[model samples]
Target chain A: MSTRISLDGVDKTFTNRRTGERQQIFRDFSLTLAPDELVAVVGGSGTGKTTLMHLIAGLERPDRGTVSTGGTRPRLGMVFQQPRLLDWTSVETNVRLAATAAGIDTTEVAPILDAVGLTEYARSYPSVLSGGQRQRVAVARAFVVRPEVLLLDEPFSALDELTARRLRLLLQQLWLRTPRTGLLVTHNALEAAFLADRVVVLGGRPAEVVGEYRIDRPRPRSPEDPELFDVHRRIVAALT
Target chain B: MTVTHPVGAEEVVLGGGRSPAPPDRPPATGTAARLTRPLPALLLVGLLAAGWQLMAHTSDSALIPGLGDIARNLADITTSGALGENVRVTLTRVTLGFAAAFVVSVAAGIAMGRSEWLRRFLEPAVLIGLATPGLVKALLCVIWFGVSLVNPVLTVALAAAPALTINIAQGVRAVDPALGEMAHVYRLDALTRLRYLWLPAIVPDLFTGARLGIAMAWKVIVLVEIFGLADGVGYQLNLEFSQHNVAGVLAWTVAFALVMAAIEYGLLQTLERRAVRWRRVALR
Candidate 1:
């Protein structure tokens, strides 16, 4: 498998102005994901999971060391925790804007919206939609660009279990349809197991990779499957 | 349509107790709703007018002219073309001043928002501008420009621009950093970023600043005209005041108020609604 995303010896630190204390989030941290691989990086809060995602997405540069995406600037798609849809535009227009920015044709937006089950609500404003629907639009926007790499920062964490599960399955199907390299930063062990081809645990101060698990399961794997539950257990054990 | 957040259902503020089931589709905002929406405001204005008329009848002084007396004078002044000429001059000065101020403030606000150095350098000056009253600015303008149209125009620009600059700078500062990251990740171009992210983030603030600026501009123009210039609404009011034409003074005041109201509610409000159509206003 070709390495699609690589971080070599990344160091990141933050200083608290009020307390006058410096905290390191990452130090010489390295990670790599194979092309078309979906990897979920799971860790407790403030474990630099999001910082890693940001580095891969090119939203931030490592203070030291190199971060490369397929050895060039990758066409990136990101679904943030919030919908982050433009409040001035309609749902359709938001997706279309992203697509147009990516040099994709506007015609592609409708089919993508249809896939996300938001066709009827195409012209509806973001404020008018529910949280799930809005997040779905955000997902559609990310996928509509046909990104070379997709980055998700706890996209489903805000949702209740049911909605999060539904969105997880939807995201999996969308990823399967396109087959792009993706990195998901999530804290849920079960979700990490369910959606990712590989689960990587991040822990310790100035976070480094603690454990990695490769799931060789087939698509449409049941959540109730004993093998998957075992994997979930193992991942949780790694987390603790 | 009935909308439920992924977390849970939001409480319905409009229907009371029970959550209002969202319609399957969005409702058509009908003309009837629009027309009746402002009825309460109209009724309140009508009540104020009735109270004023009642007081005018009860009082012995002609200084506080009745609405009818003001209306007659308004017609008389309008027919003689003084009203038209003065209004034209005042509006011209305001438009010129406001346009210049808008451009300058937006540019300055963006600069301050973007760069720490520029912000530090200009922030003190902008604060000084904000604290300085429009009357003071008008006085300075009159001294510099000597009763020319430039006097009111410059005063209005100085008065209005600072408020806009401050608000816009704060708006820019308040933009969600996460959204900026999203924009970068999506590889959105500068134009798209400006249109989708920056402007929307700043528009509510822009409107706030603009409304305040326009009001300031209106006041400053009149003040400058009354103090220095020999033309415009303030000058016309001065002429009426010297002759003790209480009805004319009230008439001109009403005319000025009407113009301000028309621009504020009619033009600015309509533009704001269009710009922020995506906002869900609370059900009144």
Candidate 2:
């Protein structure tokens, strides 16, 4: 396996205006997302999981340290918490948008829609679709790029249990089919266990990798499976 | 023709009693249909006319004109080619003034939005322009530029651009920062970034500013023409007023207002609908 992203000694400090104080989010925080590797960052609220993703994505410059990717920071696709579909476009147009921006051939659009199980509702607007379907569209759009690094910021944390479970099943199938390096940030241990190849827990003040677990589970593992439940419990304890 | 229903449930009959579903689209707007206003719009107009007639009756003098007499005077102006000339002058002034305002406002708004230093320097200047009273600006323009077309155009542009600049700046500032990141990751060129991300984000705001600009321009054009120019609807109104032809003055006023409504509801509304077709309006 080859390394695609390297974050070396990255420090991000944000100041609080009201208190006239500054908080160092993370100092010398670092991780690498390998090519075709699925890594889940498990962190408590404001542990700098998102800041790490931002540094990797080049959305913001870090206060200190080096963050670079393979040769260049490769194309990044993000599936944010909300669908973030342009309110003025239909589903297919929204999907077409990301692909069109890349100047790539649009052969992958149909397959992507099919992967997310949103092929039939291509003509529907985001407002008309249910929460689950909209989030699925966001997933489809991110996966459409076939990015070298795909950052998902709590992609399914907002959905109900049943809907989240269904989407997890679909996302697992997609991750298997498209072999993109996936870095998901979530506080949910079960979700982290179900989808990630390895879970890196970021906690304690200024957050570091407190625990790392590798899942040797088989593909299409049932949620009710005993082994998966055991893994979920261990990850939950780590998070707590 | 067999009009098929969705999902093999039922066959719906059309005007010809066919079973085909007719493609499940809104009916194409015919020319006559497009010209027709909704019942509420017609009622609004009727109420305005009724109010005018009632006021004229109560006034019991030639001072306040009846709606019919005003309508007749409007027809007289149209037939005599005077209304056309006056309308032409007013519209030309508005168009030129608004076009100039739009270009400057959009540029200023974009500039101020993108750069903090530029915004800090230019924001106070725009605010000064916005804070200046329209009548005061009109007087100043007349004093500086004289009674020609420049006075009206300058006055209107000053009034329009500041508000337009503020709104467009806010719109651009309000764009999804994430979208810009997506654009950068995809390496979308400058033109693509503008067209796909920025332009759409600001267009609704641009139109809003434009509508206000046009309205202000027309009114300022009239004021300028009444005081400065020797021709236009405003000047013609002045002439009617001098002759104590209240009916003719009222007539010209109503005609201009009606024409403005027509242009707004017809042209701008059509453009807005085309641009924002995906958005639905829930009328209560």
Candidate 3:
């Protein structure tokens, strides 16, 4: 149920509306994700980390090259920097909407809500939920779709540090339970180190992979692990 | 591990703390409270009616009908069935014209909102339509189509559509691109996107436009009827005017106002409450 994602020689550019100056974000950039692999893309601001996720999610098309998902197109579920829940819909309905869109049985929504610690809030509208709770709903939404690929763009960056840490753990636990081709784009080095199996540091104006680090530590790894700090240090260095 | 908080505190803290308790309900001081509860509006109406009656008594002018005479005339017309027939005819014209305007305005609004070229091309026409008076439009429609049902309906549509188009266009433009991206990534079908995303996004604006459009349509239809049509509320008012029957005119005008008030409060407000129940909860 896993799918490998590959972006080959992808080129994307945007022109300033007022200045008419074209800024190239990705030029001959390439990367590949092994099936069931969790890759975290870490980068500084404006390094096109989000654009890369958009490319893989098919929200944006590469200007010149192709982005393929190992022959078969996988059902993609995305979590944005904001929770992006439908404010009018309840938590359970939000998850069910994604499941419906993916053409899957909605029976999975209850379990996913439970998994994300949102069972009590299932019937509550997103507007009433805390920031952390809303993100949990988003996580439940992404998982309930039974997607082959999950793309998260700075999903926990907006939360308080304590809340973000807890959610990172929750996300890790979920990934351990049922692995998918996961791509997490974030600027937080520690978060990247904690959840991703491989950390890919992207840098420069026309972004390219500056360094790649593979975390071979086993599941349920501690955020406070000394080895994680070392890896975090190296990723931060690569980012600079 | 799950995050823990005091049982009921999470909702308060998370919901940004209940919007400051809604300005403490005024203390219920016995009969004073009960009297004040419904008194302000009723007192105003009562005062206005009493003042008009006094003025009619003092002036002894035929044009200034007292409240009693107007009520007697209203009862006469109601029993005679002219009031019902004319009301039905006018309501029919208003409904048809408003419906046509709404459908066309929504389509044109979405088109203009989505396409820059369409917006530029259609914006001038909408502005001109808004600037033109209902009387002018009514007269033009009468001139173009003669003294038929077409004049009132066409005039109402032309008068109401511009404001509705502007409202719906603003709604469409205000739709969040972030949500659009979320919809795309989730692979929501066209129908689902419209139902869950696009429709909800524009609902507040839709309600606003509907209220404004219906009010405009009512006004325009009455004007058109006065100028051209032979059998509607406005025509009845005109007939009463020609005979110098001020009581008859006032009765018809009061009945029309009552019907519009019913539609506004009983129908539109109820629908808007149901549609935007989430907003109420969010505010709380």
Instruction: Report the number of the highest-lDDT candidate.
Output: 3
DockQ of each: 0.43, 0.14, 0.35
Candidate 2: Cα lDDT at A85: 72
Which model scores highest in TM-score?
3
Model 2 docking tier (incorrect/acceptable/medium/high): incorrect
Candidate 3, which CAPRI tier? acceptable
Enumerate residue pairs that collide in model 1.
Answer: B1-B22, B1-B23, B2-B22
Question: Across residues B1-284, which tens digit of lDDT does each residue of candidate 1 receive?
Answer: 11122211222111122212334655669989999988998999899999999898899578878888999999998899989899999999999999899889988998888788999999999999988988899888998999676778788999899889988888989898777877887878988887788878899899999988887888888889988989999989989999999999989998998888888889999998888766753120
Q: Arrange candidates by lDDT, descending.
A: 3, 1, 2
Q: Which has the better lDDT: candidate 1, or candidate 3?
A: 3
Tens digit per residue, CA lDDT, model 2, A128-230: 6778878888887887877778888888878876667677777776676667777888877777777888888888768788889898887655555566567
lDDT of each: 0.83, 0.76, 0.84
**lDDT tens per residue, model 3, B42-125:** 798799889999999999988998898999999999999999999999999888888889889988987887788999999999
Q: Is the docking of candidate 1 incorrect, acceptable, medium or high quality?
A: acceptable
Indicate which candidate wins on DockQ. Answer: 1
- Candidate achieving higher DockQ, 1 or 3: 1
i-RMS for every candidate: 10.5, 13.9, 9.0
Model 3 misplaced regions, further than 4 Å: A71-73, B1-39, B140-151
* lDDT for predicted candidate 1 compared with the true structure: 0.83
